[model samples]
Target: MKTQQRVGAGPGRGLAAALGATVCAAVFTAAALPGTAWAAGESPYGFDGGAQPIKGAATSLDARPLTAGQSYRDSIKKDGKLYYRVDLGTQENAYVSVVAVPKAGGAAEYGDGITVTLQDGSGAQCGYQDSSFASATFTRPITAYAHRTIEPDRSTCQQAGAYYVLVERTSKAASPPDDWQLEIRYVPEPGVTQNGPTELPENWPSSSPPPPVGGPQKRQGGTGFHDATSLRQGEWRADIEPGQTLFYRVPVDWGQQVFATAELGSSPTGATGYVPNALVLSLDNPARGHVDQNTVSYDGKPATLALDPHRPVAFENRYSSHSTTNALRFAGWYHLSATLSPEIVKEYGDRPVQLTLRVNVTGTPKAGPAYAGDAGPFQVTADDRDAAASGASGDEAGTNDGMVVVAAAGIGAGTVLLAGLGVWSFAGRRRAARDAARGGPGGPQDGPSPFGPPPPAW
Candidate 1:
């Protein structure tokens, strides 16, 4: 790839930016402007913002400084495309954050954006893989700045040098120069050796075998930000009425999941299904996030539940009256059984500081039905309720087979329509989440994703 391009370019300057990005930037010069940090109703939109509203196209370079509260903003409108740039520049591990604003809400719209491209000196494309940071995180804005790990990619721009950072917004036309604001910021990285200011490498060692994620992961410790998302069974509902008996049972020999948790709590508003016992779990506790004794709900009549990655998860929207909605963060423990090869078990089973979780609930307190596993697969078989009660119609082994496949295909087309392209990668994990992204878009058969091949035959 072409490595070197003319430097210091701007709108109509004929200067070329690395990575072929049209928009370019220079080191920011401090301004002695007054009240750049004002309060509410004093900002450009009279909304306590810091920077004034400057509008332009994503292709232009007249970008203005982001105001104070770059993370927050006034609801302004613009008729032209919003342009912006990200500069980590020599800052060893600087993090980036961006938020886009638009005018309409009816039909789904693309609000903010960033033109992302990684390359080495001379501008040759880098083949990247195993990207911990190369992800599209929903529930949050693009956060590549916070991630310190870069994947394995062959790039021509390897050495420490100028790298282009570009971002553009995609949304409906907005009311120009009015209550409009696009937020952006740069946060520093952690565990970094030196805080040396830096930019995207113009070049890196060609012989280097991509960077390793890190070494000796801690077991039974908090899940790092990299864990991405988790699917856990939250809690049981109901008031702590007298003599309330609640129960929960999970797999055993699957070896206990150290990083995960299983919790049961109740609310006072509505007296729903009642449980006899409950308590919070912490790293300070022995069972960790696992349950104790007598609390396990099983015997012949067991319970079966599913975590819909789509459908926004149960209790995600409305809170059960019997829940500690106002009391706690609504976080719950996970009833999980993992499948790991001997190698994986050997590698992580005994590691210190593993993924640890803290479990708790906020309402009235009671007790009973706590079961923790030491070793063995959980077998919650029900009798007259039909073998289907445990969710298996016939052979339990056959029932657990192809879990990923079943979860993906069974999702409605609406959910799949909502997910982004990069997320809809694996027919398994990606597809299920995609199904959840579906809103009022095309029908379930909106064809295949614009990013990948069509779905598999059922």
Candidate 2:
């Protein structure tokens, strides 16, 4: 049998093969590029890119199970209620936060928002929280969280069983009927092995300490909790657009008290109409549980929102009557979010406004609780404190699995591209030798080509 002679064995075929390899390499590299990072000043809320898509059930009977330390993305219709299940140990504290994003440019009344509740298997309520748009005239994302703590004094809802999370949309007739986007996160805290104080501190500082004294450092805020910029005790500045929310995380160690103030710079437009709740600054605990929030009206002038001073981070704070103090029970990265109402765009001409965060973390870092099990991300580590002090963003400060995968894929693509070029060069040399043996460019070619059939004409 005669060996099938190579077809189109020449410079053209070699060049074609190289081009194909190059294209494939380029495609692979493009696919591996980071696509989840959101721009700093975007309007709409950016959900956690790594969150799992979950379908919430209408009732507890058919509710889907949510695992601890996982984030889920779902949706809720107008006036709709949804249920999710979470199994907890007797000594573990479970926190579930739901962020509801209203339709952009849609109408929303002052009372429009959501309510989150944690209930036991018997339908006994463990915790409940309500978040509303309040005085803002435009739609934005509102976060509400409910938690079930293993307290000794708690009579009900403190068992090692399955619990249900109920999320309900609370809106008036004037609000838009569109389904709101939901970002749900479940964070579990392991019970401490060592016992700490059981009573609230009798005499703690109640007055807000002075804001951090330093020149403002430029830092772009992240769009979601997972990527919130890491902030330390200093003045940080970022530009925020109307209807945009920026997230930042501050590492608060045990015995440390965090005081934060958000200042919206004077509007360049010099517009006159006053917008209530024009700027909102919120502080959330490591579990994404609401600690405190402050809002201020804006009239083209600089507006400041400052969180009230609370008890320092302590395990006993959880026994306090106030929810704010209760949320300071752990030492971890406390998230701060600054949101600009969309109503400002109407009068301010949709320009980006300067946002300044004055953060002061007081008290020396002390030893934290010894957990029976792993505390996971609920506890701040030495690396976390170092990252904050170095002004590293969340992505740079912590190990992000998504980004690691992307980097690995990128390196692999580069290797493949380099190997393909080497093969292309070898093929070209062989083709040239074969032509020379046949006496010229117009010579006969024999033997099957090592490289498969030439790629189709480009």
Which candidate leads the pack in lDDT? 2
lDDT of 1 by residue, 1-458 (tens): 00111110075333222311211111011111211322333321111112334443354244343331233232324333343333333322222333332221111223322322223334443211010101111111211111122212412333444333233323345312333344444332222232222222233222312212222111111111111122111221221111111112221111112222322222222223322111112110101111111122211122222221111011111121211111111112223221111111122232211121221111111111122211011122122112111211111212221222223345344332322111222223422342244221112222221112211111
User: Which stretches in model 2 have alpha-carbon errors above 4 Å?
Assistant: 1-43, 153-155, 403-458
**Residue 211 shift from truth in candidate 1, angstroms:** 37
lDDT of 2 by residue, 59-132 (tens): 89899999776678888998999999998888888888888876654568777788889998998888877777
- Residue 66's lDDT within candidate 1 is 34
Worst 10 residues of 2 by lDDT: 1-10
Q: What is the C-alpha lDDT of each candidate?
A: 0.22, 0.71
